[model samples]
Target: MYDLPSEFPEEPGLPDEFHDLQPQLLSRTLRLTAYSQENWFTGTDLNVYYDPTHVLWHKRPDWFLALNVPRLYNGDDLRMSYVVWQEQQPPHVIVEFLSPKTEREDLGRFYRAQDRVIDPRADQFPPPLAPVNTPPSKVEVYEQYLGVKHYIVYSRYTRRLRYFQLVSGRFQEQTLQAENPRIWLADLDIGLGIWQGNFEGVPSAWLRWCDRAGNWFLTDTEAAQQRAERLAERLRSLGIDPDDID
Candidate 1:
């Protein structure tokens, strides 16, 4: 089992710890109000095969969501990978968390740009594109081939979120409001926003799902804790010392 990794050796660094944690947060809080849980699927670090013509070519997105698909692959086994042709559906949303190695590819920039020392071209835009024969970039695969409707890029370092929507066969960057950067995906009937809280015993801002009213969904552990607290309070109200019994 250890022989084959979901993210091949070629992919950078095999992803960091935050990569593992962030996608878990997204998966836990994801409540597809538009469809039944049995009808949708989500994958983290899953290799998605897009082009049937070039069967070997694939893109490994950090996280992706697909609608009207089986919760389990073929309603039984967990998916090893997602094949677009076999599934007959492309992902509705794709999210990438920025890393130093993948920032340029994920952001569709010709040059790497982050804080600290730089050589030249402080404010210059992207340069020319590579030849068609070369392997397509992540953005190119998502935008042109897969045609993902909603593309999100987030930076944990800066706590910033960037959104892109497909329009007229092209990906257009959406302007996030200065005050409220939270995005409400109306079609999915679920909102995604950053919340500052404790998760997995760590306190930090996490990308989580919320309702239109801005209430973040509780995770399994959180829900369980809430239930236990309510039970304890009820016992106290009934004049029973819960701590003594447990």
Candidate 2:
């Protein structure tokens, strides 16, 4: 067994407010009717170790889901990181929130030549002799290494969502329904779309999960609020003051 890295380098920087709240929303609303809670695991900003040969290499996704995996490591301990070799299960869906710093890498725009040379003196030889320092982008890691099935990217600034599905061993960009801005995941029996409204007291377009019927899944707080509203409505119909009772 390969020993996991105990001290990984600190991330470049911390995420902003939107980054923190958005993933919370996704984690809270994700519900699979068919699969029990124990059958899946959701992670946010967690290291996902993919390559066994290079155990140090990892990607920290904004949010990801791994089906048929215990929520805890070995069904007991919480996972420090999701090791692909150890878990033997890759994420089924991965979501990325686009920011200025990660836009190009998230979109797989960076490429490193396979035959790049390392010696500085080789610069006199040709362009191919120059050392390539570019590492694999998030897209490359998901598509080639982890083989993630669904890759979704949402831009809060543009209010645009891009969906890609792994088909025939490659990721194909999916077309969105112009009438309704939502991408349906048949396998998961849910859809993802940009919802505009106040979430956690901040009003903006946020990424959220929707059911097959196009109903937005509610977070725990939202669900509780809805229940209270329904109770208040029922009390009013019976000519009782709900506020006064409480």
Candidate 3:
């Protein structure tokens, strides 16, 4: 029942240079130490279908992470789109990269701080249906319909990050430090925070994951370079220069 087409005639996401690299950094650094790699799945610019009734009503999040779901669809082929009901899992966390066209909706311009109530239970899923033609904003989809535990939005232009956690079936915004902002999700034994560094040779503040120790997780390339550096140091200690090798 979940065999939904992933793409449409008109693509939904607004992608630029930052859009391309930011999601890559998120997925690459999302290391859940407690869960095996195969037990977790992360999607980049992938369609997430929320309503089984309105199969086409979906959101294409910048990046989303679902836990305890097979890396492959049904342990078979790659998923064209994430059908929430079919997978029997809502995204544990969803992230959106704010752009000029999306910030208002992403930050829920519809509601104010006094309007929402904070709830500790974040289990509101299978939300009431909206008119197929008149769908809610992106934040509503993730906060209300999907009941995603964590909702993160970041703006590269402003170097500002916003975090919302689903509490008592409603999403409540969290306070963040002005510098070295971090969030610790006990459920995943992982934390996400802003890191100021050069990635792929571009110096900028990027959202990255960290362990309980607050050490940022490295991307595959960074890990490889780290290993090579350790090996070079070992070789030098043995009176052999790794750089001298052909």
Candidate 4:
């Protein structure tokens, strides 16, 4: 069993606005008819401890979703960090928003077996253990250790979305058809894709969840605005001034 850290460090540097807004969008739009909110856990920028052996080793995903996990730990307490050994459930899907500094690691291109320098003092130790120099990349941790079902990487710089599915113990990149442009997540019964439009007053590409029929879910604000417009239209059809009624 792994022990939780007494205190996890705050994420370094000033927070980027996109990082904050993007995860919020994902969380808000995630709707599963099959499972209640209590049965699902969604996290953003939260530490996830995966390796029981290496207790302190963890990964902080930009956003992630775990099915069949209590939304609140013990049904009352909020989780400080997600410990895989204790939870006994892995994240069904993990998404990473790529930055220039983290692009290589997020894509699994930073892993180098040759770069691992084993400790030379292992032979003298009673429990003979060798320490590796370089930590495993984020992709390696998710694909090899955690066995996350789906791993997604979105590059705001390139405005491109990439998908990877774990198959036969490895991650295989899934293709996005140009016609559809959405990756279907069978487990969650939803699709994920990039939506080009203004979000939160910013004109940029944002990741969004869509239905099987290719209908993008609207955010709470968007839904409210839409409702208001429909009401105004109905009032106009009835030969009444909606603005005057308001």
- C-alpha TM-scores of all predictions: 0.87, 0.84, 0.86, 0.82
* Candidate-wise lDDT, in order: 0.82, 0.80, 0.81, 0.80
> What lDDT, from 0 to 1, does candidate 3 have?
0.81
TM-score of 2: 0.84
Q: For candidate 3, write residues 32-131 as lDDT tens digits.
A: 8788999989998888999878877888888899999999987988778898988889999988886544555667853444423333342442333344
Compose the digit string of candidate 4's lDDT tens values, residues 152-242. 9877776667889999989998888755468998978998988887887898888999999878998889899999999999999999989
Which pairs of residues collide in candidate 4? none
TM-score of 1: 0.87
Per-residue lDDT tens digits for candidate 1, residues 60-176, read 889999999999888887988898988899999999987655677788842345532232443453433454677788899999998999999888877878889889988888888
How many angstroms is residue 37 displaced in model 3 relative to the true structure, after the best TM-score fit? 0.5
In model 3, what lDDT does residue 26 have?
A: 92
For model 1 the local lDDT of residue 58 reads: 82
Q: Can you tell me which runs of candidate 3 are displaced by over 4 Å?
A: 1-3, 9-12, 109-132
- Model 3 is weakest, by summed lDDT over 10 consecutive residues, at 117-126
Instruction: Provide the lowest-lDDT 10-residue window in model 1.
Output: 110-119
Q: List the residue pairs that clash in candidate 3.
A: 119-167, 119-168, 120-168
How badly does each model clash, as a count of residue pairs? 0, 0, 3, 0
Question: What lDDT tens digits, residue by residue, belong to model 2 across residues 30-148?
Answer: 98988999989999888898887877788888889999988888888877788988888999999987765566567774323421223344345322232255457778899999889
Candidate 1 colliding pairs: none
